[model samples]
Target: MEPPNILSSIPFKQSPLNPGELNLTHYCMSFLLSIPWNDISVTGFEYLAKKYRLDVFSDTSNPNEVLLSLAGKIILIDVIIPTHGTYRDIRIALAFADATGEQYKNTGAEEILLSAIHENNTTLLERNVALLAMLDRCSPSVQQSCFQYLETLKSTFSLIYTSRLNTQAFNDETEIIMSAEGKPLNDNDGNLGLQLAFWKHQDFLYTAKISMNELPSNSLPCALYGSNLVAETPLKTSGEVSWLPETTMTQIPATMELLFEDYHIVFPEFGVQSLLDFLQITDLDLSENFLPYKTLLNLPNQTTAGYPSMNKSHIIYLGGIDIPSRSVHRIPYSHPRQILGIFQYVRQYLTLQTIFENVKLSSTRITATASLRLNLIMKQYPVIHIQYQELNKLSNVDPVIANVSVLPNGIVQLNSIACGNTPINEDTALKIQKMLQKTLNIGLVLEFAIPKLFNNQ
Candidate 1:
């Protein structure tokens, strides 16, 4: 007889996780995300939107945003925190993670992970096992966590990679901050010295600053400026990508080096590091394989505690080499950066000599913002999307794309798109509009079918 699929039999449905196991994971993980590491807090995520203008999502109601990824795939979600406090907010995310499992479900040490959490005093055996298992899978996020928790799981986990990400619009601001702050970048206060400071880069409107001091109070070797201590889980085929580099650049930080080292260490079969060491890719290669990193370079625009809006700023990285941060040793990539002087050498400047190809505007007259057109968007839903129509006209794709577009005002939107170039008869179009209207009329019933006993939005 074939061996039993223990995973499918035990932890999943057959032998359901007990109540206590569920609660232990949920509460513990939630507490972990909120207080992952104290030393490196560049900006509370809330500061990004109201003050710094780092737009990560269009919606304003639910703030805490998380990038859920498995291997090379990345999914961004603006989390709905069930509670107001940090510990509670993280718990909401933890619940979501438990529900979605995602990349965390594939781990070989499922029971081991659960046992570790249960072994701790913080864990409560009386809690529901189903809830704990659910949280372990999806929501609270599998990236950043407290020192004790992270250290405990280090043996099995690959590495948590936290890359400071933003759009190209914030490039100027990113360059300014990187330039101002050198190797020991956290120099805000005088003689005693401040951790970091925020500066506005006129070159780029969405400007901000971060320093690494608060993260490591004493013996901690790792210190980051607004960057979270993410845990990079191991994937079978493709590893998750926080951000992939677009072009070939040099004087890069220890971001790649650390990733290469840690990733290879965790999954030696992948053979990622030996190649770099043997071929000395660090010194010889300059390919388009590297782009995203958070070594005091680009800041996560709206994902943290302080940021405001999403898509408000584009980010550009100048140049930075990995250096030693004596204050924090855990981060081998924590080094001084060389944004100005080395940029010209490490970066290839754009030098397009060709002229424009061809373009012509249709003679069709553009309509003004008449009351009729404006009211069309405000009829049922509070938003209107313009890009889908443009893309449909240009690429000739599906015309019925639900592009959620919002006006200058901030309001929850629930509605439909206007009739576009889709070859739909008047009858079908009307039917969809009517059906959608009916669903909305049901008082907005969104649910998970079965009754789940946990926090709800």
Candidate 2:
């Protein structure tokens, strides 16, 4: 026969209250019921109570009897805590019945207790009192453990609260100040060694001069100028003064000036409308890949160069008109003249012509019958001989041979072209040779007769 399951033998019932409705008493009772009380030592009970923050003392109560009384007290505390709701009458009735070993039907006391606890906020002191009273009735070990746990909780709470208060105080009292200018100024005492002056022009340009008693010890003194505040380097510096200004457009009613080390600048009729207009343009929601032609056309004439004469209709043609379309299919082969025209168009923009030295061509039936000559310059060879022949309709083979000779002018020449049994005519060959000489700047092959003096020697 199998040994009995001790937990199964013990009387345990599920609480009628829902999870949200359960109170501290329900939790405590559940915990107590789940433990194998017979196996747990007196010391273990004390340790558990302390760990759980239950106010139970080890020395004050009988270990066995205290367990039952502790359960009763937990019930009482749960009922008494106003926040948890008053189940005092129900608890007392249960206690009386249990004392007399009389069986009583469930009166929904657990549900009522849970409802009261959740609805109210009991004071910490009151909660502590309830916990202490509950632990006082528990086993000696349980009481000891509970009391220790509660004490530790209280100490931790106090420490965290105090630290938060100190941090708030420090943040409130501390103040940090930094000078926007390079150095501090004492203008009140009339020791004004630094001075800034401004001059304005009709074209909305301003010039500023900064005069100082001595040169700056650290990095060069920087001045911020412009309606939108741009940093400007000094234009020219004399013995004790420097000019810090830039030739930039400004708007009417202009107050823009150079700002440095507490020195102030004032200009007459400076305008800020231009800067605001620029900022507004910058803030526009424009497409990343495409420009908005309509937005550009709507800009003020003064804001854009040649805006008055710019045709708005032309903008539509310009917008995305130049962008290549994905839907357009590529032409694999075109008329040889058309291909040559494109090559010539591209070649006009090319600074170097060495890229065409050894042009690789795939023979296709589409351009097989067409004969074309291409000029190219080779860096290694003075002359290159290229021969092309069609073995059959399927394949046209071409072999390239470079005949290089250094000329007297230190130039490489490619002066020969031999087409073996190909469709190239005499005119095509002569054009090819001439084109090569012109493109590569190769000199003609010179013929010289040997002198009689050299023959006699």
Candidate 3:
């Protein structure tokens, strides 16, 4: 059995009133006038009709119940007015409820009417009540029109209620149920069922639905009737390969275990004497290193006899190098330069050796564990390390460093020189230390190493 489309079951009648000529105010007044009020006073009814410019009492047959009926209709539609003008309006509006002995009751139509009269605005109350009453007898098209009109009025009365009714009507006409897997299911005995399908292509997913219903005259799917079931188009993209410029070396243990046996090779502990021996053996001249230290040390000796004696205060320590006390024999200026030269050479050599060891160990570990197939692939592509010496170099133009200490555990400690002209302050030093620790994931300690004189001196 073929099921009928839900849309065909809803009755859609045209309204008698032309859409363009609809006026809510006049419609409400007219609806009130048509109601037969058979329980109202002749004098009071005439007063109300005159107040609103409405002619509702032309043929008053039952004077006793005429006003009562009018009040009942007004209350039924929930019309209300404020009590601004001396109890006159409230007295007349609640007259019917009061006469029927329902004025003081806590619950019922009468109490609601009395509350509405005391609280709500009369103008908005009348328009909303009239619109609701008229909508009951209105055709679907006319109801849609009236709904639009009520929206523009912004009365905040029956707008939500009327919109809900429209939505209910739409839902009833279109009975669509979508399953959890996004399949549209139709239990109705329709001509044929439609099925929606999805397919994944590369990184994107595409969706389409097919129906057995008769195709439209201009549909392109009809042209492929007896030919291939599907068609394909190639998508274009740039063929360039992209690579990350910077990659970190994974952290390996300081010591590694061997399957068969273990052996360790400790590098010779080179000192200042070893460096001196190397310099002498290589026949390297130490004149360049001695020049800067010598110039500074000779300042006091060269001063004229009449000139004020240049004390320890005159000698400024750059690079945070400690000076011997006056009482103790002063070491020759040549010693410090020799120490510095040896320190610089050893530091550079150790840094390079560490890098070589790390790279070699990493390659050996990878080769041992990799499968035969992986080994062949890896042999074709060898590991390469890119070294940038200046990547972490400090700016020589600012933030002068007095001394630097590199610990065995990969910690680099810096001491800032205390000079009146030096740019680095406590705050700037702290910031640099934190940034270094965060970026390199290493320990960094900063200290101000100013030279202080003892009381004995």
Candidate 4:
């Protein structure tokens, strides 16, 4: 008979996670759309405005004012379209409204509005294509209404809009800040420094600076100035983009070498040594076994503490490389609980690596073990799982058994360790125990989840 699968017998269930402040999906302000007053109608627009009802002034004298009805409550939305500026420069005002039509003062409304608008935009775009293909089959009036809605919606829709007088757009403010030459990139107090650059060619913004501390004393000063063409997308309408070197140009920091400037997208993987150096974590003497399984990188982004919004920001989490397949799986940092749980697993792996190296130096043979049990404690429930893997192979050696646990506050605790020969010395044993109890020293936490646990297998 074959040996039983350790994962098959364990019971696993979905548990609620306390994401804490790490969740960046929600925004402080509500979402808004800025279509012209004439476009709001009874027939062709129904698909776009499903549940919410729009009330436009019939007097034609007050075309700038529009009211939105949500769940029988009416909220005001101002429609202001500038005649002179480009389509990208137009600004509209929007905010969350409750059932009573007043402003929704509660947090988390932005997440709902963002989701709703994205869904609406997707449906409209999909239908617009189908209607265009069969335009010749329809009447002139239907064609006129359909074309009006599509054109107005495309030019007016935006996530970054002003609800208050002091509200500033992200890209515009970032451009001005980068252009100011004489000022230092970081404040003298050494707080988090974040710099963002929009790449027109790639259509995705790249983070220019994301360090928690100031640059090295010997490092060159930041040499970033605002680009001339940040949002010029005339070629995008035709669906045919011609490559231009000018579009790829970015304000490079003086610290980055030529190699880094070219392939900066993969900085999370290549910048590990820089992170380790900054943290002052030296003399690791890392082995192949430890490097493969214990490595992780935190994506660079601004802190969420006291920040107003995160609707436009992009977040990424990267974990260790799978040696066999050479595939790296991304860990979603949607919650603080998920991050802590993954880090707990990495702590266990590091402890195992230390034990193996100590044994090898002492000329003691250690037989590969089959099972290790780990407990992950959360606020609501405690998760128990078993790992089956061998550190190394050796002849005439004793098998080892280890049990580990992680407290809710992210402190790793070594429950027990057993070996037939007691090959681990007191000094080595004490060192391993400390490594188990250590907390992560990084400013932001990036973690690795047990593949089985995340997959709910």
Give the distance in Å from residue 70's predicted Cα in candidate 4 to where it truly belongs: 8.0
Measured with C-alpha atoms, the lDDT of residue 150 in candidate 3 is: 23
TM-score of each prediction? 0.17, 0.14, 0.15, 0.25
Q: Which sections of candidate 2 miss by over 4 Å?
A: 1-143, 167-457
- All-Cα superposition RMSD per candidate: 26.0, 37.9, 38.1, 24.2
- Expressed as tens digits, the lDDT of each residue in 151-216 for candidate 3 is 222222122223322443225211111101112222111201122111121242222222111121
Q: What Cα-based lDDT does every candidate model obtain?
A: 0.22, 0.24, 0.24, 0.26
For residues 1-457, could you state the per-residue lDDT of candidate 1 as single tens digits? 2111101112212213663243555445445543422210113223222221123333334455333211211222222322233322321112112224443231222333233233431222112222122222221234432211222223212121112223232244344333322122211111111122122222322111221222111222232212222234222123332221222222211121011101111101112232224323231112222322222222222121110121111111111112111110111222222112222111110000000000011122323111111111222222323222221133432323332222111112334433345343445444544433323211011111001211111
Task: Name the better of 1 and 2 by TM-score.
Answer: 1
| Candidate 2 per-residue C-alpha lDDT over 1-457 given as tens digits, one digit per residue, 9 for 90 to 100 | 2111101112233346753343657567757644532212334434434443444432324332323122332222222212233323222111212224443332333343233334332232223223334333331332223223323323332332233334432232111001001111211122111111111112322111112111111111222112211123211132111222334412211111122222111100011112223222121111221222222122121111111221111010011112211110111111111222222211221111121211222222232321222222223322223222222321433422223332312233334433333333456445544444344321111100001111211
Best prediction by lDDT: 4
The lDDT of model 3 is 0.24
lDDT of 2 at 350: 19
Error of 4 at 17 (Å): 37
The TM-score of predicted model 2 comes to: 0.14
